[model samples]
Target: MPRHGRLHIPGGCYHVMGRGLERRRIFYADADKQDFLDRLGETLARNGSQCVAWSVMTNHYHLLIRVGDQPLAKLMAPLLGGYAGHYNRRHHRSGYVFQNRYKSILCDADAYLLELVRYIHLNPLRAAMVKNLTDLDRYPWTGHSALMGHRKQDWQSVSEVLGLFARGLGTARRRYREFVVQGLEERDSDELLGGGLVRSYGGWEGLKRLRKEHVYCIGDERILGDSDFVERALAQDTLKVEQATQRIQAGWDLDRLIRRVSQYCGIKEEQLTQKARGNDLSLAKALICLWGSQELKLSLREIAHRLSISQPAASQWVNRGRKFCRELGIEFEVIDS
Candidate 1:
């Protein structure tokens, strides 16, 4: 069967995992790992995303990221692509570095944030990369050391993770450590990995019990959440799909969108395509970028070409446009079909 399209919800938290091609080692030395981390830090910083927990193993890596306005793909593309290029060049090897597109599970933060933190940080110990929790505290590859105050990573959201445990920094760290210790006995958790109905219900036994009780819960492989959360997310996604379809069927092409935005913003259509900077122009361009991609199903490359701007700039505008529309109560009126 074909894979499901990645579900992109702005500001959602995701548990992301990537493995090396053919189950080979992605990192051969400390330098390789350091390169990957450096790239990740830069990518997260530029994209305004937060990494609460991360672990880099020999063949794979995991990240718990709370995304900002842009889709998660914007952040992952550069990080994974840059690292893969760097790895291939340094090793004098060619071809793909990663097994495939990295896996990402949109998690219900309230339910799985702390659990995922513990699971990701404890990866080193589970793989025997570190002898024990004490060693894991000092282990450099995982974010555990940073949380434990044994190592410093300016990029990792140490405070955010610790803040969840306690108000005071020191007390929070202590409590966080205790929490990690308590989770050491947990075997590989399939529920944390994400799945459809079976994993969402907890396991086979949980499913059986629910079935016996005549209880039904919605689930999706792309999402890790309770029935309500899954239903809400799916509903939102369906609405977006329907809206996009309506826009396309209504003849919402790039030219028509540009003309409409220009008319709404009270600017000449030509001004939007020109290199200019002003509040009105910026907002107009942002709307074009946002609506063009979301409603008209235009790619960033296509949007950038139309606006005469770089692809990266187009992405930034999409994020800005989202915030602008939300804060200012801006809405686009559909043109007559």
Candidate 2:
């Protein structure tokens, strides 16, 4: 089936999840878990993104993050690709690393923040990892511990979730624990997880009303929480990519692109950071690097020196420039054209 769509927005908050194909175990040992977390940390840092909550299970993982200005495609490209490659190499395995494209739900922070926080924090308990309330309080994989002010990691921005609860961290933890305890005892109910209108409402009647009103953003019935959140998040993500791509094609580089890259694109010096790759981006980068070596009167050795790429690789990039131009269906103009 063609995909339904995606939800996305600048500064959108999302609850993201990925499961293994056929429900297979993706992490079999401690090293696998640690490596995955390491990748998570690096990706968030490198991408200039923030992670609110996350947990790694044997076959699935959960994350709550706020999307920055960069489209999910570009932002996730390096993070997911890099981690998949590393994991495959280390495990001596090949083929797909994650199931499908993964799920990202765009949540209205004001309405759903506390509920979603509870939902994510209690994931381990829902899986029976902790067995009891006492055990869940300290479950290491979740941001719940950090929210309680018991375990703090700078990477997990607790303020957003923490702010929703009054009575401070200690009081919040006690109340939150009770909430999760009740939630675990009640996960069987469709109403609690599948909210209506907002992440807070419940009941079939409420959902029926939402549907009647032509509401979107409902979540998958098979999964818990609001489906509308997922729907809207995916849509916004697609839109963002389109807009960023248009800006790049229009020759307006907002990120002050590298001079060498500008010379290569023949548009301006800012297209490199315009966040629209599609086909043009890769070609532009390759062409720019190539022009630095070929037509600019810059020697391969000098080009390699300037770009910090090896002379052979630099020459190959230049050689690939024309081919890339043809492949992208872009006209080739000399450097500084």
Candidate 3:
């Protein structure tokens, strides 16, 4: 069967896994692991992605990432390619160091964010690299140490992960450690690893619910979420493609988008960042959000930064923009393919 197209929505959360070729060791020593991580950090920053959780095992590695402007594929290519070349030259080895393609599951952040963090952090114990939680805490190959305040991987977003637990960092770390300990006794999470509804919703329980309700579950191996989320994600993915095509036809980039929206609304582009109470300004901002997200595929966080507003506000503007477009029958300007 043909492979499914990669899912690349900005601000999306994903669980990405890659393995060494034939299950061979990717990291032969601490130096190798360090080298891989250094490359990973550089690649993530360069691509505008953020790492929520990650584990570097001997033969495989896992990453929980939130995509920004760049697609996940773009971010991973250089990281893996660069690391592979370095590994081969240093060890006097040859051929592919990693599997041809990595597996990435676009996940529903609200449902599996913390669960994934715990699952990924526990890989050392699951792989028998560490004997216990204490050892796992001190283990350098995983983001668990960073979460536990044991070691610092400055690129890892520990505060964002911990913020899910509690408002205060001290209290959050304590709760986070307890959560990790609890995850140790749970069965290995095959669902989080891959698949659709069964994997997305944490297994057969979800499948049974869909069956009982006689509801068709929209699912794919590349995505993890409830039927509604799956439907929304698929719909948005289609919108991204369509809008991207429209953008190409219009030859619109960020600068062009800002100019077009500003001119249409008869407002100065400089005024977009101001908190004015005019309806036209609101429309212009809404258009900016819609175009930025649908046409540019930018993350809400990135949009917020550019607009000098909070992420929530950016999200609200996006919603309003969608509503405005719907009301006005303003679909992206279609062009002949």
Q: Please report how far candidate 2 places residue 76 from its true position, in Å.
A: 3.2
The stretch of ten residues in a row with the least summed lDDT in candidate 3 is: 195-204
Candidate 1 lDDT over 105-188, as tens digits, reads 887664467889999999989889888988999999999999999999999999877866666889888888988987876666
List RMSD in Å for every model shown.
Answer: 15.3, 19.6, 10.8
lDDT, candidates in the order shown: 0.79, 0.58, 0.78
User: Each candidate's TM vs. the true structure?
Assistant: 0.64, 0.55, 0.65
Better of 2 and 3 by lDDT: 3
Error of 3 at 17 (Å): 0.5
What global local distance difference test value does model 2 have? Answer: 0.58
Native-to-model Cα distance after best TM-score fit, residue 153 in candidate 1, in Å: 1.4
Instruction: Write candidate 2's Cα lDDT for 170-203 as tens digits.
Output: 6655665665666666554444344333322233
Could you say which candidate leads in TM-score?
3
Each candidate: how many clashes?
A: 0, 18, 0
Task: Sum up the clashes in candidate 1.
Answer: 0
